[model samples]
Target: MPLLTINLNPAVDTVCRVKSFNTHHVNRAYEVVKTAGGKGNNVARIARSAGEEVYSLCFLGGASGAWIAKQLTESGIYPVSVEVGEDTRTCIAVVDERDNSVTELLEPGPVISQEQQNRLLDKLLDLLRSKTFDCITLSGSLPKGLTNEWLDQLFAELCSHDIPFIVDTSDSRVLDLLHHKPTVIKPNVQELESWMGTAIREENDMIQAGYDLCRKGAKAAVVSRGEKGLLAIRKECIYKVSVPKVNPVSTVGAGDALVAGLALGFINQLPWPEILRKSAGFGTAATLSYTTGRIDSGSLPSLVNQVTIKKIQPV
Candidate 1:
């Protein structure tokens, strides 16, 4: 079955590569690539690369939005776009090859009016009624004019249908959605701490916080800890996933790739171990590759094998 992805705020990401980026000075870039991006859009791309059928629903407006639609279509993703009044935003990622570090400048995105929000929601409902999906993913940030309360209502509607939903978003938004009880939430360590309003100083602290979120409403919480790996807390068990050492090209969209992996595993009903393996492997593959949200297919099998998944027995 195809996975349904919702990206309320989509963008065109420009990735520029520079050997040594000097601040306050003119720098030359050897390579530049641009693609359709947003957290949900990235998930769609990565999931498709992993051989999953995906359908993307997003809001598009003005010239940039039109361009993003074209990019999505070119990427072999079926785009179901809703028209809006404002221009879609653009984001820039400067990859410093010297250090393999990525500096990002993100736009706030278009302000979604109430009517536009309703239209998008209605479109989503129609899609849900017309098609059968393995799962649904809601990602990226909420554009202006839409509050967390609005997101709660939308998620409640999705929950009413009993479809599993995965969410990856900003820290502030994560707290509000916990009440709605999404099937899964992927937040980084710092983001998780912010959502919980506390500092997570160690591995155990992170695990407990993830579990706390699970008890509140989320069925599971996946806390991303960059190169250190992943810590996942579910009702049944907790997972610790780590990848083999490798020099990262750009970390830009690796988290999104991880989300895609989780979606794939959830849709396939894979065991938690297999799920974390895929999640870590896909993330590592993306890091090994130059493109954002894309994994080297050849590297996945071996990379996945390199992923170490340790189950922490619940007391």
Candidate 2:
């Protein structure tokens, strides 16, 4: 079965490398890379690289939108795009080589009109009726002009389907949608803290936060903690996943990579421990690549082996 990824607010991501970035000064980039980017799109790309058939459903407009579609097609991902009125957004990430720090400038993407929103929903529904997907991932921020009702309808429709879906986003509104009971909810440590409105300073705090999400409505919560690896929580058990340290090239899409791994695991019905190992492996491999949403595929096996998974007592 194929993976279907939905990116409502997609972008053309531009990554520039600078020796030492100084604000308020002209710093010429020594290297630049551009790729079709959006959290969902990244998941699609990584899953495709892992030999999974992937479909990317996204909103596109103008030249940037066309470019993104083209990139996806070239990447072996089938594109199911809905045309919008305004151009898609372009996000820039400046990587400062001095300390490997990244500075990001993100544009508010095109405002999706009511008509466009309906069209996207209709397209998605039609696709769901026509094709069967192993897993569907809804990722990234909601585009401007989308109303809460629109999201409600989207989630309602998704829930009506039998296929499992994962939600990976930074928007706090995810808390509001937990009642829909997505198969999994993925949030980074910072995103989880923001949603819970509390700092997670200790391992217990992190486990408690995961439990809170599950208690509220999420069937499962996978919290990504940069180099510390991941904390995966379910109603029955919790897991502490750790990956070996590596010199990172960019951490931009590591979370998305992890989501892709999880999707793949669910698709294949892998054991829970194997799932976390694969997910963390992909995330760690992503840190070895400079591209926004890609991972070093060759390093995945070794990384997966190096991943340490331990069952943690729920707080």
Worst 10 residues of 1 by lDDT: 170-179
> 305 in model 1: Cα distance from truth in Å?
1.3
Query: Model 1 clash pairs?
Result: none
lDDT of 2 by residue, 126-222 (tens): 8888888888999998888988888988988886777778999888877887888888898888887798888878878888888888887888898
Off by over 4 Å in 1: none
RMSD of each: 1.4, 1.0
Model 1, global lDDT = 0.85
Residue 249 C-alpha lDDT in model 2: 78
Candidate 1 displacement at residue 8 in angstroms: 1.5
The sequence of per-residue lDDT tens digits that candidate 1 reaches over residues 10-110 is: 89888999999888999888999988888899999998876778889998989999998888888888899888888899989999988988888899988
Q: Which regions of candidate 2 are displaced past 4 Å?
A: none
